[model samples]
Target: MTELVPTPNNCVLPRIRADFATFNDAIDYAAKSEKGMNFHDMRGTLTRVYPYSEMRADAVQMAYRLVDAGIGKADRVALIAETGPDFAALFCACTLAGAWPVPLPLPTTFGGKDSYIDQLSVQLQSADPKVLIYPPEIAEMAAAAAERQGCEGVDWDTFAQRPAPEVELPKADPEDICYLQYSSGSTRFPQGVAVTHAALLHNLYGHAASMDIGNNDRVVSWLPWYHDMGLVGCFLSLIANQVSADYLKTEHFARRPLAWLDLISRNEGTTLSYSPTFGYDICARRISSQSNVEERFDLSRWRTAGNGADMIRPDVMQNFVNAFSAAGFKASAFTPSYGLAEATLAVTVMPPGEGISVELVEEERLSGTRRDLSRPARYRAIVNCGKPLPDMDVEIRGENGEVKSHHQIGKVWCRGPSVMHSYFRNQEATDECLVPSEDGKGAWLDTGDMGYVDAKGYLFIVGRAKDMIIINGKNHWPQDIEWAVEQLPGFNHGDIAAFAVETENGEEAPAVLVHCRVSDPDERVKLRDEIRDKVRAITGMNCVVELVPPRTLPRTSSGKLSRAKAKKLYLSGEIEPFRLAA
Candidate 1:
């Protein structure tokens, strides 16, 4: 395997347009250039080098074939989103065919066959796809899921063999629905976020313009295609801006994360990349086990190292920078931002070259508890997720639906053209969160996240509103508690889940579920006591700490620990507690 896959001569950057009416229109112009996408493996080997011209041609053929297969405009085409050439081709084909492509999650590491099948069945039922498509590797599970949904399942090889229709292809309009993106569903069942071409284009334009994206910018990513950030930010953004991108599958990154950096090191062009806090932490830890860190990679050209899809941790970012600085990695390249599936992808992006900036807020101010002026003050570091994109509005809403001031934490609400049209087929869910704005120009999406903006307009997230633990009248973010426990030895991220449970007296008390790897009864009991002490020290509340076997905690498709599901399983007695036999 070659260390570097040389960029094609024709992949030279082009003059980016201000905006496009639709993604198809964007791709149509991008195809005029040679810039395209490259997919790599865990060994940093380039498996496929797909240019825009070939992709456009292949997509056109696939679009006509789908038409011949009896698919019509606005019909749902369910795609098992894996990072590869087939999924990309089929996604573009659906756009050109004027059909709504619903990108569904691939099987996760946590879920077994049955769990995956159930998840697939739920999404297929909601999407009501005309046809289901998947890679051959998971043909059995995909076929079973399609059978449950009563839809025809076709693998990539079979789908490619179909003949194209001998007729003019349908074109997609700006107002037409582009695709359905199911949210990460960390706290609840996944709902399909209906994104239109106009909304998607608007967000893409904002993303490019906000970052001042130029011809020199190149993207490298391992984010999953099913998620909004990976699909819109990495895949579609490159097409719309006529920039080249390199990709490693999410699973590959999990096994050999250094390969991602190695790929970047070999590429000379200006690099732009993004990941959650965990991504950075794991890579830094892996570096400790290997030698020759400085000579193996060159990250000086990586200008924009974005952090999103989860809370941005300053300590983790600092560790990564320190570990890789010898190899020319800059701490100033970190761009912490915030967004969700509903906003299409990005709501706020830190300007290029600004790095990661954060503010220190008093603990009482952050937790909504009264501070005793006589006591010594303590502060928590909240990373600043830069200003909102041009024309987007963000506000902090209090419990009464009134907006809050700066430094005041509340539910984060946003209004912008880039927001989704609605939650498909779920009016109740849509109405529960989406509300009209005062100006009546557009509606505000209740992000269901709690955060506040500083005077400089940078957003700072606290935690999920629903996940905030309330004991008496004070609020405590679960992540803060979880992070505190994670600081202990022999623990890692996603190993702890915290929530509020009602006591026998009907008062809310914090309960913690820790994934215990200790076997000895004495050590297990000691670990439990340590966790309780940690929680009590932080929040001043006695928390019930229960230990469970490792890997027993539930997780979302994107590998995020699902606190809601954990709580449900614990309440129902499905998650058995770890006990030492006397």
Candidate 2:
């Protein structure tokens, strides 16, 4: 048997050019370097080494084939965002062929086959892609969705073998649309974010500059390619910046969460990796009681552990540090960031070495409510999401569209080259969020997220404005209820989802759906009571608590809790709760 050798982390090529004019140009330059992408299997074993040079040649072939097939400039081509060479090369090929590649999500564990088909069909209708390409493993479902949308669907492997007569590929201009990305919370009628080559490159520049991507830096990622962070930061940024990277399939990481660390341990060079807070929570729980964290892992060289895509939990971050401190993981390496799909990827990233800095703000301030003199003030920990990216303007706007003062939490508004041009084919939705700035310089995007910037210019996220549960003129964040229940014995993150629902009397009240694992009938009743009591203590009023089977709660494609969908399912009678013994 031959030995396995991963791609080198550094190359002798004189680094990136001044800057890439377009993503296609970035790909052309990266192909000249020796650095490339390394693929790992489920158990952290090296499986394939995909060199940039070879990827470029393959992409060019596919580009010619795309042109021959009548796929031309600005044509939309949908592709299942799988973590593999076929998808990678095909994505690059789309840019080379001057088509907007739409990166759609793979079927997640939360949604079944029919659910996944419905999701794909909705997105296909929105994107109106000329074709939908996917891996053969999911051919049946992919083809079904494509057929429903009246579009052609083919597996990437077979498409790769299609004849390619030499044909002139269309030129990709900097202002041309680079790709289409849908946000994670897209259960119905989701608008696609249309990003241009110029916007994509500018965001990449900001992301790279903020992180200070060093010469010795290598990235290890398990984030799904469908999300903005994974697609732009880890995948596209690496190419445009001419850096080497290693990847583990998101599904494999789900099965063995610690394999992400194991793969990182095998790489001795300094590394940058990212995930939402749940990723760290999973790994820490996986090795919490174990004593071999230091023995099995060498995380001494891990330079950056990025946390984003959700609200950063400091308690979870602290728990991770306690579990991995023995493994040489530093608390200073946690780089929490804040961004959205509408911004192309990153708006603010904490500088390296400035780990998690949390501020204790009154819960009422977070919800913009009057202090209740009857009860002691409750404080919520808001993590500092760091400063704005270069050329990215950050502002907090009140309900009247006026800019708020420091420590004032409101809608997070940003304007920059990286902000998406528009939502595909949705003029009303575009006009809803992208309002013109008072300065008349550029349009500012209302992020729909509630946050504030401090005196030092570090941003702090409160929560999503849409997820707030308002009852009787008082506001309550769903996380406040969910976190309170998670304090009980058998609860974990994502195990509880909280939202607002109307009572039989048409009065609004907080409703919580918890993933219960207790089997005994009496114990289930007792557990439900305990959860209700816990939530009531937090809300100062009784909440509707339902105990559902474990994993019944739905997750977004990026694995974040889908409170909106969970509420929808519960109301629609799809998620039946266990009946309590009377």
TM-score of each model, paired residue for residue: 0.81, 0.83
Instruction: Give each model's clash number.
Output: 0, 0
Give candidate 1 regions above 4 Å deviation.
1-13, 185-188, 372-376, 468-582
Task: After superposing candidate 2 on the true structure, give the runs of residues whose Cα lies further than 4 Å from its correct spot.
Answer: 468-582
lDDT of 1 by residue, 435-554 (tens): 988889899999888899888888888775567664532345677678879989999999999998767854457899999998899998888888888777656668888899999999
* Candidate 2 structure, TM-score to reference: 0.83
1-582 per-residue lDDT for model 2 (tens digits): 787677777888777632788999899889988888999899988888998898899999999888878899999999999998988999999999998899998886644677678779988999999999999999999999999999999999889889899887777788999999985435355679999999999999889889888777899999888888889888999999888889999999989999999989988784799988878988998998888888999998887899987667798899999999999999999999998878999999999999999999997786555887999999988999999999999999998898999999888999998999999999998999999877787899998888999998999988754676645323356776787688889888899999987699644578999998888999998998888777665555788889998999999999999997898789879999999885
Checking candidate 1 for backbone clashes, the offending pairs are: none
RMSD for each of the candidates: 9.3, 9.3
Predictions in order: lDDT: 0.84, 0.86
On lDDT, the leading prediction is 2
lDDT of 2 at 60: 94
lDDT of 2: 0.86
